[model samples]
Target: MPCLLLAAGRGERMRPLTDTTPKPLLQIQGKSLLQWHIEALVAANARRIVINHAWLGEQIELALGDGAKWGAQIQYSSEETALETAGGIRKALALLNPEPYFLVINGDVFCPGFPIAAFTSRFQAQLSNGNKLLAYLALVLNPPQHPDGDFYLHGEQVNDKPRDADFEERKLTFSGIGIYHQSLFADLKLGEAVKLAPLLRSAMAKNQVFGEKYAGPWHDVGTPQRLYELNQSYDPK
Candidate 1:
């Protein structure tokens, strides 16, 4: 499957740093955040990649040319303005549309060792089954900054609400990583700014979304403190 690395966010919270550079290009531990994801994706043998950019997008193009250095073929989706998650995906549909399922990763999040091959394998298993799965997400424990969390995961299914009265469910934060069927963004128009949560929720209500809790290392590098702390304390196991 191909992959889409979302790099178009304005990164308001990462001011000063993001003021001069795109958030995905910000360095952490030696490599730029976006590079980490690219290397991981290449390592997993998912080489064809698409990156969308708006703010300081030129620098992103300069920083990682054709991805040939990493043995990956990369194409770019340029937006005149920063389009939110869903909108960005919609804009890049031409590149991603070739495959029925494509992986999307947040450019700002730093989860270096994430098992892309394994995750996609699991998602493929879900797809091969008779059930029509629209999305498969990787959920993580909520960080201190976002204690309320985002979605509920019940068994292999993801839910917008805790519907099962008899079974307990854990609300988990979206790891900013997921495999999506192209149809999920079929209704969206190019260049329109839109968030991805509402679409996921709609799919969740229909039991079309599946997710698994990832216990591996994951970090949402949204703020300066989180970035600083990760640089100072992160020890790759």
Candidate 2:
């Protein structure tokens, strides 16, 4: 499946660092966050990459070029202004290929051992079995910043319910990684800013959304302090 890296966020919280550089270009262990994603995607054999950018977008193009060095064909979707998640995906749909499913990940996140191949295999198997899923999210344990979590996962099914409603299950944070069917953005207007949560919730209500809890090293690099902490603790060697 083709991959889309979302690199267009303004990084409002990242301030001075993001003032001149896009968040994905921020270095972690001597490699740009975007580069890390590209290398990992290439290693997984998802070689076709589409990166959509808005804030300092040109720099992203200049930094990564066409992804040839990484053995991938890179295409870019430039937005005049940052199109929030779903809108950006909607705008880049044409570049995502004709396949029914594609992979998407947030650029600013740092997830070292995310099993993209395994996720793809599972999603494909579910699809082939006629179990139509609009979206399959990778959920993680809630981080300190988002203690309440976002969605509840019961077995492999995800729902927008409070954790107290089902004491047996715990709410999980969205890791900003997933495999999505093209139909999820079919109704979205191209280039319009729209958040992905509403769409996911709508799908969840219809039981078309599925998710898996990933117990791996995942960090949302939203602030400079977090970036510094990651760099200090990360073993690049």
Candidate 3:
């Protein structure tokens, strides 16, 4: 399956640092954020990658080139204006079309050494079981910045609302890592700017969305302080 890395946001919260450099180009532990994901993905043997960028998009192209350095085939889905997650994915559907399902990661978040292959396996396993899931999200403990959380996860099912029954359900923050079927965005028109949450919520209502909590070091890295903290704590080992 192919992977799409979202890198088009203007990074308004990141301010001056992003004024000249795209958010994904911001470095932590001596590697650009985008590079971290690339290295991890390539290490997992996932070689087809599609990166979408708008702000300073060319710089990303210049830096990563053709992905030869990492032995991957990198393609760019350039946008004149930044498209929100769903829109970006919809626009890049052509590149991701060969595969019924593809992986999508938010370019700004930092989660080093994520188990991409494992998640792929889980997704495939579910598919083989004959479940028609449209999306599989990797959820994480809510960060301080987003304590309210995004979605509720009960067992392997993700829901927009908590169930009234007795089973355990915990609301968690979206780690911005997910595997999606191409059909999730089939209703979206190409180039229409749309956020991903609504679509996921819609899928959740139909019980088509599933999630697994990722108990790993993860950071949203939306601000400079968050980036600095991550770098300061990084052991580089």
Clashing residue pair totals per candidate (backbone < 3 A):
0, 0, 0
Residue by residue across 86-151, what tens digits does model 3's lDDT show? Answer: 999999989866468999999999998789999899988888888889999999998999998999
Write the residue-wise lDDT of candidate 1 on 1-237 in tens digits: 889999999999999899999999998888899899999999999999999999999999999999999999999999999889999999998987656888999999999789999999999888778778889999999988899899888889988798677977668999999999999999998789999999998998889999899998899999999999999998755
Per-prediction CA RMSD (Å): 1.3, 1.3, 1.3
* Model 1 RMSD vs true structure: 1.3
Task: Give the winner by lDDT: 1 or 3.
Answer: 3
**Model 3: pairs clashing at backbone N, Cα or C within 3 Å:** none
Model 2 clash pairs are none
- What is the lDDT, from 0 to 100, of the residue 84 in candidate 1? 92
Residue-level error in angstroms, candidate 2, position 65: 0.5
In model 1, the clashing pairs are none
TM-score, candidate 2, is: 0.97
lDDT of 2 at 153: 90
TM-score of each: 0.96, 0.97, 0.97
Weakest ten-residue segment in model 3 by summed lDDT: 162-171
